[model samples]
Target: MLKKEQFLSYSAGAIVAGMYCGKLELNGDFFAGYEYGTGISPSLDPYFRSEMKRLEKEAEGDLKSYCSLARLMFYKGNKPKPLVAPLLIDKP
Candidate 1:
């Protein structure tokens, strides 16, 4: 019986760890290129855009709604259907 805060912390930790490994995909190219002004390949733009649009619709374009949905997904033993994980490591 984990407390609410603890559960949130653990869920976040799991997401981080998953991102650290290769099991999960990185959140977005903007994050990947934070230090540099780069992004996903132009060829992949359409695919990424469509995926984001789908997620946006799911969240009703609201940040709070998106977060709540993401948390619920985590609680329900499912990863949020969005590229929400943050980059955990940088590769050379």
Candidate 2:
């Protein structure tokens, strides 16, 4: 028997996976965009900022940290650029 929050967490993860699966191939920045977009929001700025403060006092996972950091990385209305993937190197 799954708890309500646990079930919701799994469902949320699945939904996010589905939404970004295609974009993953299309844009290298897909994951970064998703992290920043979902984690940090103008609507939730106060909450996010507070959560960040709490996290700073007691650091949370990478997702929210990325968004909190994004605030410092970019100006309002300007999104930080996506991180590029390293090229594959064939072993000799």
Candidate 3:
């Protein structure tokens, strides 16, 4: 198991790397635009929005509550009238 600080550090690095990767890919595509003999349209807004939303969702949910394969299976099998992932099923 990783120490708390180390885990946090790695997580931050991963997020930063993902964001940086997206930017790099977009930049590379921009430079390679002439391959198709047409101007490439730059659109990073949606990508950035999706990344922000993903980060927000992760921040809002607790890892403990989101994890546990056994618990997830139990809830999946015994889900009320409408079956859904345990993580998404709202508690009364």
Candidate 4:
């Protein structure tokens, strides 16, 4: 069985990875442009916003699944493991 600390660490890492990936997918280009003072395209604003919302939802779902799996592992007495594998596995 994974130690408590190990499990917590795994969970934390998973959460951070999920959030970061989500952020990148959602606002990567916008943030890059904003940082470089590039003006936003008016025509693309709506599309960007819609895409961001979708990305955010996807990220949240990913995070929730990560947490849920972590909880299950903990309950099952499985050893604390890296977060990447679980996240990479497809879910139906």
Name model 1 segments beyond 4 Å from true: 1-30, 33-39, 42-44, 61-65, 71-84, 87-92
Candidate with the greatest TM-score versus the true structure: 1
Deviation of model 4 at 13, angstroms: 18
* Tens digits of lDDT, candidate 2, 2-91: 333332332233223223322111122433454455553222345434443544343224545433333333212223432222111112
Give the clash count for each candidate.
Answer: 0, 0, 0, 1
- Give the alpha carbon lDDT tens digit for every residue of 2-65 in model 1: 3333333333433343333333433344243532343224224454445444554544546555
Which is the winner by lDDT between candidate 1 and candidate 2?
1
User: Model-by-model lDDT, in order?
Assistant: 0.39, 0.32, 0.32, 0.39
Q: Any residue pairs clashing in model 4, and if so which?
A: 2-79
> Model 2 has how many clashing residue pairs?
0
User: Per-residue lDDT of 1-92 in model 4, one digit per residue for the tens?
Assistant: 33333333433443334344332112233233433464433225454445445545654678666445534432222347433323222122
For 40-87, candidate 3 gives per-residue lDDT tens digits of 221233444454566445534643332232133223234452122221
Tell me the deviation in Å of residue 91 in model 1: 25
> Of models 1 and 3, which has the larger TM-score?
1
Model 3 alpha-carbon miss at residue 28, Å: 26
